[model samples]
Target chain A: SQTIHQWPATLVQPVGSPLSLECTVEGTSNPNLYWYRQAAGRGLQLLFYSVGIGQISSEVPQNLSASRPQDRQFILSSKKLLLSDSGFYLCAWGGPDYGYTFGSGTRLTVV
Target chain B: QKEVEQDPGPLSVPEGAIVSLNCTYSNSAFQYFMWYRQYSRKGPELLMYTYSSGNKEDGRFTAQVDKSSKYISLFIRDSQPSDSATYLCAMSVYAGGTSYGKLTFGQGTILTVHP
Candidate 1:
């Protein structure tokens, strides 16, 4: 079975501080990875998606960026955090065969 | 106009009652529809998926898609308190290259089933 893991289930960062969130998948290879942020009532917004290592397509223009360092490891980072950057961050993996699976998510609070 | 629209219902129902959640879309190119359940402070979980116009049922959950009307629905039979979660509707175009596997979601409908 395929599973996704996201770190720092809860995070509290000061404004203008650097931020990093990591996600990884197991039991699959060359699967597509995605980063999504969920805000209260705004729905799930796609932040970035990667088809392969180093191939990232961003869906929104913001302070956040994503990277795929390995086949199953995806990272989300920001040089400086904004108050609006606080939200629920979810990582998901999908493919033609592997439907879609989401991680537990990281609740980031920027003060 | 948004590509997808869903009523963000804070709907409350008694146990064993039937629950209906719906979403409407303006994009005719979308052919895949899905329903997801998200608990408070948790990630959304896929509950049902449909390829096109038709109905698909599994256990107590039924998913209906009407492409002609660009509408989709998720029906929960004998709803339980455990079903108290936000339901999200998502859609994507088939074989959308580069954009493949990308999903557009609607603002979720929050549901609460009291015991």
Candidate 2:
């Protein structure tokens, strides 16, 4: 079985502070990884997706960026946080057969 | 028009009643359909998935896809309080290139099952 781990279930950051959220998947290799953000009332929006290591695609332009440093490790980072950056961030891994397996998610609040 | 549209229903239903959640899409290229359930402050879990059209049943949950209408549905029989959550509909294309495995999700519908 595969499992995804996301750290810092809840985070509060000061405005203009740096942000880093990490997600790692175990028991799978070369899986497609995705980053999504869900705002209040709005649907889950795709932020970034990676097909392989060092390959990332941005779905929406924003302050956040994603990186696939390792095959099973994905990281979402921002040099400076904005008030609008606050939302529920989700990490997911999937394949061609089974659908995506999402992590517990990181709730970010920029104050 | 939105690629995928779902009613954001804060629907309330009694226990043991049948629950129906639906989503409609404007994209006809979608070949893979899925339904996800999310609890409060939790990640969405893939509850059911169907390829193309027709009906697929697993235990108490039934997933229906009508490609002609570009609509998909999820039916929960004998609903319980635990089943109260937000349901999201997602779909993707079958092409092996960039579009493959990329899912576009609906806004999600909230359902509350009272005990």
Candidate 3:
């Protein structure tokens, strides 16, 4: 069975501080990975998606960026955080059945 | 219009009742449909998926897709309190092997099953 994991399940960062969130998947290779953010009580907003190692497509323009350093490792980073950057961050990977598997998510609070 | 549209419903129902959630889309390229469930403060979980059109059932859940109408639905029979969560509808094109799973989602509908 495949599983996805995300780090720093919760975090609070000061405004203008750097941000880094990590995600890793096990039991799968070269799967598509995605980063999504959900504001309070709102729907998900796709931020970025990676098709393969070192290849990323950003869905929305913002302060955040994503990288796929390995076949199953994805990272979301920001040089400086904004108040609007606070939200629930989710990492998802495509499945063999054309479905998606999401991680536990990280609750980021930017003050 | 958005590519996909779903009612942001706070639909409430009693336990054991049947629950129906729906979404409509304007895109004709969508050949794959899916439903996802998300608990409060949690990531969305894949519940059901259907391709092309017609009905697909798995246990207590059934998924329906109408390609001509560009609509899809998810039905939960014998709804339980554990089923209370937000349901999101997503669709994608069948772009052959590698491009098959890039999904576009609609705003989710909130479902609450009371005990």
Best by DockQ: 2
Tell me the deviation in Å of residue B13 in model 1: 0.7
The number of clashing residue pairs in each candidate reads 0, 0, 0
Q: For model 3, what is the error of residue A24's alpha carbon versus the real structure, in angstroms, after optimal superposition?
A: 0.2
Q: Pick the candidate with the highest lDDT.
A: 2
Off by over 4 Å in 3: A95-97
Candidate 3 residue pairs that clash: none
Which digits, one per residue and each the tens of the lDDT, describe model 1 over residues B1-115? 9999999988999999999999999999887888999999888999998887899999999999999999999999999999999999998876656535778899999999999
**Alpha carbon lDDT of residue A102, candidate 2?**
94
Docking class of 1: medium
Candidate 2: where is the Cα deviation over 4 Å?
B97-99
Worst 10 residues of 1 chain A by lDDT: A93-102
Across all models, the iRMS values in order are 2.4, 2.1, 2.2
User: What tens-digit string does per-residue lDDT give for candidate 1 at A1-111?
Assistant: 888999989999999999999999999888889999998677999999999999999999999999999999999999999999999999998842235778999999999
lDDT-wise, the better of 1 and 2 is: 2
Could you tell me every candidate's TM-score relative to the true structure? 0.97, 0.97, 0.96
